[model samples]
Target: MSSSDIEFSSSDYAVQLDLIGRVNGLTAAKNFFSSLRDQDKTVKTYGALLNCYVRVGLIDESLSLMKKMKEMGFLSSPLNYNNLMCLYTHRGQFEKVPDVLLEMKTNGVSPDKFSYKICINSYGARADYDIMEKVLQEMDSQRDIQMDWCTYSLAANYYIKAGLKEKALHYLKECEKKVGNDAEGYDHLISFYARLGNKDDLKRLWDLQKSKCRKQTNKNYIVMLGSLVKLGELEETEKLIDEWELSCKTYDFRVPNVLLIGYCQKDLVEKAEAKLQDIIKRRKIAIPNSWSIVATGYMNKNKMEKAFECFKEALAIQTQNRGWKPKAGLISSILSWLGENGEVEDAEAFVKLLRTKVPVNREMYHALLKAYIRNGKEVEGLLVSMKDDKIDENRDTMKILSLQDQNSEVTG
Candidate 1:
């Protein structure tokens, strides 16, 4: 059928929306809705407008139109609500979605695969596995709804993000039982187990390799190993690396923190320092985190000066291009080093220049502490001042305390 040969009616509105979606007629669709909305034509026109906006990722408009269509007495439908919910979901907009769902129930519409998936993904984004599992339970309760691999994959993501590795493994294992041994889920499960430093699971995965049945690569090995390192399962991690004939140097920055940390552990200062530069040579990868790992390694090997330099470079590079300020250690390292170097005045100035984050002025308190101890500059007044204006103990503050005046502070 020709384009004009098509009849534009309520039943056919969705189909027309698909055609216009392909042609990118979003504005035309919206203008058409505004211009030609009589009671008879309004429902279809508004629905078409909603579909067009959703197609173009104008989800707010699609949601707004859903409300207008409902107010105009358009009947609830699986296709309509499903599509609208999907649009809301792609934007990660969950709060608005349940209201549309309520409207669906009010209009006698039933939830289907699309609505179910949206809820799964939204809850996963929030890492609210309790509610995410509830969604799965609710879906299971209704015979009309069904779960697919993507559905279960999303649920598994909820567990992973929430640090419920055991729960993730259980859900993925259930997925395997239900779906006859899925390889992707198994790979992911192994990765999670490796992250948790679960010896039994890691051994099994390794034994599978040793039996001449499973093929492993640096990519996959480091992917798992690096995750374990970040979780700080250091002793188990060392043994695993010694057990496996694995190499991590070739992995991307996403998983190469292991290489950095391993170099630090072995006191391979230059190798640790070069990992960041190696990652930078790759195309189109934002490895701001490589510096953090490198800095730690350098610091461990008594290379604090170079570590400080690397941190500054990383923070400056990250902040300049991406508009994201570094945190968790970037500022802390600077303040800590400035205190150690007895450059408290310079550190105080640097703290003020932080564009987005507020720094605890601990360097001043502790700086004076060191000053009083080293230079004997009157502790009576300084002690009272520090007590009154103490730094609130955050993670960075705690790190400063643990590492202050560390004997291993140096650079190669």
Candidate 2:
């Protein structure tokens, strides 16, 4: 809607202020909040403005706002306390999180699930498992509070990180029981199972999620496929692809990209290339990243010709002006090989394309120079070209030019 058509109330403006600040529009949000301050504003407006400061990572401003909020009796809300706790957590001051929780309690503000979870995370991050458990136990003991699946899943995550597999498994089971058709929850559990190498558990949960969800989404397929791939079960992932093709309503290249990545990861570049060709033959679109992965695999195998072709395919598939640049090392490898072996005209054409994506580095110029020297073309002309590109002649460039001149004198 046009600005003139939209007249936001104080609360609407407050939410907008918070949103703007989140996107790094702090100056604009601050000005708008200041304008609202002179008019009628509620505690919610103050809270939103404080949230803006926090979202923009203005720590000093956030702390000042917190003090102002307390003096104005706006600290009675759990949201204000939680925001401070979040700020401390974001700043890596884990020790400060518990203090905020304690202050909240002393102020007669009951800790919500989020408050307790944040405190638990703080302790878990410090590997203070004893205190983390105590906080969780305390949360469970509260008559007004009911434990959530998120807390259990979070506990499981930390336990997994800490190498407490038994406790992690227990909490994971608890979390699974509370999944309740939440797709993200299922994805989290699947990823955790992949980390734990619990293949049986992963399969069971995948089936359970499929039965619970009304219609499996592309993301669900991708997550499961990725987990299977991580477990080195490429055969199973391919079978699932068949199932997904039958059920999916729309085509998203990312669904099969997981398999392409997996095959390349295993050094099976041929299989990955075969899959890519199959997709093309079937008239389905594949993403450039898939081709790049296979290219990387070929590079690792020292198959520069195949790698260069795959890399070229990746560049050709990109939409106009997509800002895609291949990794630097990959570009260097292909250019160096092309200079040594490719036709001089082909090397020049490819280097021309490469310049569009990367700056003219000394190494790339060296390649073009070597290409010209090897093909008995004008090495001096390439030197002039390098000068125009502002690339100074290095020792290697001098060596190449000197050797070419010596060969020319001997032939004359």
Q: Which model scores highest in lDDT?
A: 2
lDDT of 1: 0.60
| Candidate 1 stretches greater than 4 Å from native | 1-64, 71-110, 120-138, 141-146, 153-170, 178-184, 191-197, 202-222, 230-253, 261-292, 296-304, 309-412
lDDT of 2 by residue, 90-148 (tens): 98989989998999999898998889999999999999998998998999999988877
Candidate 1 lDDT tens digits, 175-259: 6454334444445656656555575775565455434434456555565576566555566555655444344334344445675
What range of 10 consecutive residues in model 1 has the weakest lDDT sum? 403-412
Q: Which residue pairs collide, candidate 1?
A: 302-410, 303-411, 304-410
52 Cα displacement, candidate 1 (Å) = 8.9
TM-score of each: 0.48, 0.87
- What are the clash counts of all predictions, listed in order? 3, 0
Write down the RMSD of all candidates, one decimal each: 11.4, 3.1
Superposition error at 366 for model 1 (Å)? 20
User: In model 2, which runs have C-alpha deviations exceeding 4 angstroms?
Assistant: 1-8, 19-24, 320-325, 355-363, 379-412
